[model samples]
Target: MAVALTPLSIPGRAGQLVSQLGDRAELHDVYDETGSRVYHDVSVRDTHEVRELVALVRRIPGAVLELAAGSGRLTMPLLALGREVTAVELSAAMLELLSERLAEAPERLRERCVPVQADMSSFALGRRFEVIVLGTTSISLLDEEGRAGLYAAVREHLAPGGRFLLSTVDIVTPDDPEAAEAVPEAVIAAVGAGGRAYRMHDYWPAGADTRTVTIFPAEIGDEGPVTVCTTTVGVLPVDQLGAELGRAGLTVLSGHPLPGAWRYRDVLLEVGVTA
Candidate 1:
């Protein structure tokens, strides 16, 4: 859902890592290291997201287009189900991993997975699909203008009667003093095989504003502390998000907390068309 920058290396080689690791390597080394592991953990404790998505795909006709389809986690399974999928991913490293994963699948399955490296906010595939999905809080990463651009692009590429599915993490508003105070002190976001732990914390520098400054600090085994990764994102409250999409000419069909989503809500929407 949230993108964390690559952490400082294993202490001794910290400088080497920063020097040798390019942007893509930095992304893979830290940001992407635990991508699949988290998915596996969630599938065991909660709902298998891919399976739930597969069920949804079964009801819709035509091809599937997944935005921000990192490493093809969802796209691969959709392809395995004999559905054609166009995966839009921005990270080259993620696309590479996705390609490697697809290669291991059966030929028929591999053939159905189309990987495209493009920004979701402004991608032109020149085709429409029955289903379009922006998975795992990808929408929250954007500002108002970016969100509008993404919705416009999605609308442009959505076929008649097609559905747009997405999930967003909850962001508390200052209007609710009690809920704002309930924000966690820290969350253990991920754990690696080598006993490393990635921790995340959120704070509001500008109260009442949806903008949040998130800090991700990691502990690499017993090695000394390293530099932390910081990112700022606009976290839209649920009702406000729905209103924004409505202004984009999208009608919210359903909005509810997904089974096992914890703090996220899944929304289904359709293009507002006048008959």
Candidate 2:
């Protein structure tokens, strides 16, 4: 479907923008320990989430803006599908790795992928996109205030009729308080080249709070165990999410659960401007 996006005119605001989790040192060590190449090779590839996102993009013909495009996992794939993609990433390490990989691609493919080092919450590319995607539940990394900032940014960059999509691991509701409190000991987070592995563990605030902890424990090929990086994020329910979107002038058109063993899912939001 074709979209026509006209910049919205606000009464008071003339210029505005919005702005990651964990400290720089912690993020750098984590990504350095697990090279971007290995991370993409293991965590991305033909995962259910990636496939679902690809399918969604195929339906929309135009440019795409991918938020939190860590290491170009989704960016490269979308470019392969002949979509012009602008990837906004926070971690400098991640963007550096993405640039390295993109440099190796054929000129035609490389030209289509634009790598921008910027925070997802507040970035302006001076244009709108036909499709905007926030895969890997990256939005979960933000608190309530930050999420609103992100939604506002998305709205500003989204073309009229453009679609916004995102996914996350389901948060257990009150019907299952036990499920929310118990933290999983270890789960395979990623497996890089040469069988290197990354494990994830949930630590504190596992219940009731709008926030929770996510720690990544990586095992490099020969380095053994490296220091873990902890990221805190909000586990917003669907109702709350819908309300947030509404507040941002975005509306959910449909919601679909991605194919996976875990309760993983994504939602489609469209700018609901009445003619």
Candidate 3:
């Protein structure tokens, strides 16, 4: 399950949408069964971290453990590396989609992936991995305590001289300062891998601790049932995250900045166990 979920809400345009749909609106947690398909469809359309992540993984040689391996976005590419990958996920629904995708992959790649249904914050694989990944900024899904537990688990699961690669949102200070107020929220039209169009709404205020995201069908009528996926994501500043990692006995090795738009940038941090 998606951890420490803040209350889900449909505000602004999406709220107006719900008001229009009335009883016809079907609300779903983004990680739920029906929503997992939507997540998978959308994930298949994204290429955000695949290249940078795979490049880093290629330098490391050994088994891999992917946390919150939803719908096999990074899982598939990680398997393409020809190393044994253990994909740990909390959502059975998401894992189901991943399993189906793996079933259709080439026999060689199909045989290398091991999918396990388990929480990313707390899991015992009874083994270690050279590369332990928690991509998609998924570490933000957990609360403080949960993140601490995750760090401990990662430490326990890292092989000798291993590295833990994770990505988190990086806050960029604008030169104008007024740029944040100028863009409080944005709605973008995107076509998913399933060839369905969606209107994504992201409401993130400057310096806010959390952001609310809502997705709706690009073409929704008033009468029929409409599926709306929503979730709340917490923002973990790079400095704060570094401190947390230090407290957990993990030392930051290097940070690589990723390109992004709309007032948000992602940074992939390479960390190792503190000596």
Candidate 4:
């Protein structure tokens, strides 16, 4: 499927606006437009907690599968560590960037990683995995039925004694406030070699316990302004999440804060095959 590409933009402060987009494809484009330094800085500022989740998984063994692999940030790192990896993603735009990165990767690393374009809810590869991961709070993307189906699908693909690791925001916490009044932000920034810079910002209301992102692009060159694109996402609570997993026939091993008392968003879970 051909993905519609959109330029990164923000109305006022482009930097903050791009920060709000926060999706894999937009972030990848920002990295391509700026540089690794900017990308790393932004990642650290926005997703610092993900590092802890990475550390936790580093101790595990065998092939790992990442559902909704996005632009392959975590998946690539896993391959660099010599772990066999398979990625399943729904967005063609994100997967395209993932494929590009994989092409530039070392042959050995490339050998360890494979990308499959498919939804996490019902994709079947006819194989099981030692470890399966769904990152970036992917579970919340699904409705209740989709979430349940995804749990069953993950369980079906997990090898005996294997585990599934997932990370999500704990929306039930008091800090989240009632979802009706939340404002979502999306920010983008870029600088040209001529010392000129451009930025874009977008904001909108996301549903209850949800985040909405829009991208706008500003041209430092002779081009005009344009609104890039938008994507919406949802967040779920831990207790309700566990019930969903239970319905999928998986057992929870752990769900807690992600090591650093980061934001109210907790790691929320680890599930293993039921005996």
Residue range 1-275, candidate 2, lDDT tens digits = 11121112101011010001112212322244344444454565545577778887888788999999987777888899998999998877788878888999888889988889888888888999999998876777787778878988887888877888777655433346576445332244665545656554433344433332223445333333333333345566566777778877777776766654322234433333223
TM-score, every prediction: 0.70, 0.73, 0.95, 0.70
Q: Write one digit per residue (lDDT tens) for candidate 3, span 23-135.
A: 67787888998888888887775889899999999999999999999999999999998989999999899999999999999999989999999987889989999999999
lDDT of 1 by residue, 1-275 (tens): 32544434222233334344334232322224344333322222333355556777787878989998876667767787788899998777677767887888789998887899998888899999989987666687777888888988988898898888776645433565666456533243654334445554444432434433222335333344343444345566667877888788887776545443323335433333222
lDDT over C-alpha atoms for residue 188 of model 1? 39
Residue ranges of candidate 3 with Cα displaced over 4 Å: 1-8
lDDT of 4 by residue, 1-275 (tens): 11343334332344444444444234323323333223323332345446655665776788899997777767877787688999998766667767887899889988888899898888899999988988767787888778877887897899998889887766433355454244344345644334434343434334346644433434422333332344445668677787777766788898756643222456647788777
Model number with the top lDDT: 3
Q: How do all the candidates rank in terms of TM-score, highest first?
A: 3, 2, 4, 1
**Residue-level error in angstroms, candidate 4, position 110:** 0.6
Ranking by lDDT: 3, 4, 2, 1
Best by TM-score: 3
Which prediction has more favorable TM-score, 1 or 2? Answer: 2
Candidate 4, superposed: residue stretches over 4 Å from native: 1-49, 172-209, 218-223, 259-263
Better of 1 and 3 by lDDT: 3
Candidate 4: RMSD to truth? 6.9
Q: Which of 2 and 3 is ahead in lDDT?
A: 3
| Stretches of model 1 off by over 4 angstroms after superposition | 1-48, 170-184, 192-231, 260-275
